[model samples]
Target: MLFIDPENTPDFKRSLFNAIVAPRPIGWISTMGPEGSVNLAPFSHFNLVSTAPPVVIFSCNAPADRHEKDSITNVRATGEFVTNLVTWELREPMNISSLDAPYGIDEFELAGLDKAPSRKVRPPRVACSPASMECKLLRIVQIEPQRPGDTVSNVVFGLVVGIHLDPAFVDPDGRFDVARTMPLTRLGGNQYASVGPLVDLARPSPRHD
Candidate 1:
């Protein structure tokens, strides 16, 4: 086995970290700019952070120019956003929305996707998404730049205010059918993946003294 240190590695070599982490869920986030222009983007560095109050986080890495991504900018300005689930069927549109378009450009229009009204947020959700979460900004945590010119990362935490679920994907037992939904996920580089065969495991029961 080869050993490597991230801090000592070259800029290009550091990208291997993403691949080592394996597949990650895509956060199909949508936000409205101050002037109401919609911005849609996909972030692989996203996941649920809590369940009691329902919190999620997505990290936005600064572009090469060290500028904040439009998704983060809009979230900062409006304090609201929506996270739409990316399914196998929506993969193309989800990838299209990742384009680094100029400010004020509506990615929904660019991707030719219809917008569904969010119940608790100004930003809209993808009309065809099997599920979506309307969220209000909880806070933003910034990852300090490691080197002088290194880009920073902004982790946006949100409190889930509303959730929408398509009836077709929800099981009669009241659980979201993960296999049926076929959520899209990101792999290394330009690769993507979809849900596959699942393994079921039961947690060990508590031990008695």
Candidate 2:
């Protein structure tokens, strides 16, 4: 196996490493205000940060102009948001929300998605999603916060307050099976993938004869 230090690599080389971490799950985050203003966006730099207290995180990278993304801003404003699972059926609509648009324009309307009121959050959840998590802002850590002219980078963390799941996608054992959900994951560039074939194995006993 080839081993190399990440710091020694060039910027593009590091970026290449990120891209090669294939088929990352997309975070279809939605946030809104008490006044009804809303924003929806996708970020591949997202995953479950923990499960004990039900925490999740998604990084809102610094924009080209060194500004934080609207998702992070709105979550900070309202202290609540929802993360909808991106499935194969909703890939096109999900992509639509990724475009840069005016802050107040509801991406749900733009994507022609139906909104369902969240049980524990102000931000309405996407009705068509297989699953969605309502979250409260735990913290927003500004990674390498800007000094005078330095570019800003930030990572937002949340504690999941509630979860909504479709009955159709639930397994007999009460688990959210990815195969049944047909979830889509993000790949490098303009690529995305659906859930692939899965295999299972049994663990061996620790006793040595």
Candidate 3:
């Protein structure tokens, strides 16, 4: 087995860190800037952290020079954003929105994506996504810079205020058929994967329960 200190490791292997943390859900985040400009970007480090209050978190990397990414900047400014679920059919547009463009450039128009007005937020949602969550900014936690010229991590937590789901992906039982949605996820460098065949695994219980 090979072992190397992550912080002091060579630059060549830094990307391996993401590759090691395989199959992360893509947070197709959309936010409106202070000037009403729209921005869209994808983050691989995203996940749902709670069920009761419906908390979701995604992290953005801020370079030492270019600190505070556009998403973070917009979220801080507007306190509202939308997380759109990426589907197999919408993958190209999703990737298109990830383009790094000049500030104030509208990604929706750049990517040729139709926008749907969110119920409780100023930011718009991608019309072609299988589902979307309108979120209110809860808080942003900025981690200390690891080293000189290194990127700082801006961890943003959002509370789900509204949700929209395409009826086609819903099951008769009133639940989302996630597999049918063909959700796309990141898998290390230059790789992506889609939801596979469904598997049902019941949780084991103790006799006392």
TM-score of each: 0.95, 0.88, 0.94
* Candidate 1 local lDDT, 1-209, one digit each (tens): 98876566565465586797868999999999989899999999999999998999999678975379989999999999999999999999998999989999999999999999987789999999999999999999999888644678999999999999999988889999978888999888989899777899999999999
Instruction: Tell me the tens digit of each residue's lDDT in model 2 across 128-196.
Output: 998999999998888784344335667888999999989887889999877877888987778898987
Candidate 1 Cα deviation (angstroms), residue 15: 1.8
- lDDT on C-alpha atoms for all candidate structures: 0.91, 0.85, 0.88
The true-structure Cα RMSD of candidate 1 reads 1.4
Better of 2 and 3 by lDDT: 3
Candidate 2: segments with Cα more than 4 A from true spot: 1-14, 145-151, 203-205
Question: Cα lDDT of model 1 overall?
Answer: 0.91
TM-score of 3: 0.94
| Model 1 pairs in collision | none
lDDT, candidate 2, residue 78?
A: 87
Per-residue CA lDDT of model 3 for 1-209, tens digit only, reads 98787667665466787898988899999999988899998899999999898999999777444667888989999999999998877788888888878779988998999999999999999888889999999999988866654667889999999999999988899899888888899987889999876778999887883
Write down the worst ten-residue block by lDDT for model 3: 5-14
